[model samples]
Target: MNQRTFRTAAATGCALLVAAVGPACTGTAHAASPVGLATARVADAVRFPWLVGPVVVAHRGASRAAPENTLAAVDAAERQGFKWVENDVQQTRDGKLVVVHDGTLTRTTNVKRVFPQRAPWRVRDFTAAEIARLDAGSWFGKGFARERVPTLREFLRRMDEHDLRLLLEIKNPQLYPGIEARIVKELSAAGWLDRQHVRRRLVVQSFGANSVRTVHGLVPEVRTGFLGNPPLNALPSYARYVDQINPQLSKVDARYVAAVHRLRGAHGHRLDVFAWDVPLQNHLGIASTYGFDGVIV
Candidate 1:
């Protein structure tokens, strides 16, 4: 079946299941394994209205089909019926927030050829205007030669148009100190923070715990996620501010998932566990088996 068709069927099935059972039944069911341990049943854990089942977040906006972190990729993801899409945000030399995955432009953009004098081609060294002059998608394929790196504002507008959720990551936080406040300011200026649905559709995440805390303080209504797995002992500290714990797939297990679910924070909210960088279709089952609340694919 085609992507759109498959997504429609999946949505229908999920709706029926939810109607028959309930949202609580959407979570994975555990059973005893041969190793004398419990294995979780494959079930939906993400409870958001836009998210129907075990969340399938499009990494860098369906990057497997189009150039990563470009408008083309975002369009591809929407076409494929992904409600949640992930992207990295970094500030340019002029302090403009642009969506790109790497600290350097060499891997995804034709930066070296455009600016031969700048050897390292770090993103922070170039202005947004200069970054826009380079082709971001041509490196992936010739058909996308016109694709350019989109500013955070532009990307957020596209997401709003499509009614898609965002898993926005603050990349290289140390390089851009106070980026959390800036992100909140931009979101507010775009009227995202004021809209109830828009706020629910947005999640701010970062590898830096301090950055996550900053976002929590600036926009308490918006959900914040921490990118890496801290020690089990540190989960309580994380629960104090973060709404979600996004750990690398390798770092999380059934026990870890249980521990995360058990954590309670201010306002009696339970912590959510989302696993990241799941690149293969086969691993989706593995992630669900481990009882991850969601997976970034």
Candidate 2:
């Protein structure tokens, strides 16, 4: 697979800054069956080497194959054997949580064609019904026109059905308050909020320390990741909450990973370091050489 080289620090910083500024489940009574494909079974089923290695995380599902943040793309990623699929979530004006990469639909949907007057509708400004009416897939290609933005609940249901795992990124912490609580409530409603055994399924990540801390408070057992530039000292406040610290591989080197490993809170659990968007091959080398936990690419 041809890999995209990491861009300069300036570009990465700009993207993350805008992203920081912007921006599932439920079940019937208990049964013998697991709510989200038994955690034990999932852990046992895919024993990702405790050893660090390139974890084939689908960047917004199988984004290269389909419009990102859609069920079709997620399914394609699962079918293709990606160990985990990642997605970004934002709150709609109606307070419904939806799977989307941006704070607005204009760039990915034919919103302009349909709502000519609302040429620049922000995702936060539109109600769920209005947002749903926008064509979310045709921009990717005509054949994908059937695709629609999915709700967190819908996405989790599908994930449970397919027995797929995820690396969810909380995109906008400031734009919407109580998102962490909402996320936990949604997962619990879908019957996945509480699990006995947890090491690596249903991971959540965010560049915002507040968001990461909120998720940690809501579901402490579930693993959480903090994404940012490194040296580890830059965000000392975050070191306490996240289970893992994820940074762009381009900014991190062997020494950087080592420094992150040394970070510790009053309790034990040293933060696992996960680098993002590395080409598949470089990912292997970093994991093997540095003893880092994984990469999200």
Clashing pairs in 1: none
Listed per candidate, the RMSD to the true structure in angstroms reads 10.8, 12.7
lDDT of 2 by residue, 102-168 (tens): 8778877777787778746778887778777877767655656888888898888877777777888
> Against the unseen true structure, what C-alpha lDDT does each candidate score?
0.76, 0.66
Judging by lDDT against the true structure, name the best candidate: 1
Q: Identify the candidate with maximal TM-score.
A: 1
Across 114-207, the per-residue lDDT of candidate 1 in tens digits comes to 9999979999999999999999977665667899999999998988888888999999999998888888888888767866644468888999
In candidate 2, what residue range of length 10 has the lowest lDDT sum? 22-31
Summing lDDT over every window of 10 consecutive residues in candidate 1, give the lowest-scoring window.
35-44
Residue-pair clashes, model 2: 6
Which segments of candidate 2 are over 4 A away from where they belong? 1-52, 196-199, 234-236, 264-267, 289-291
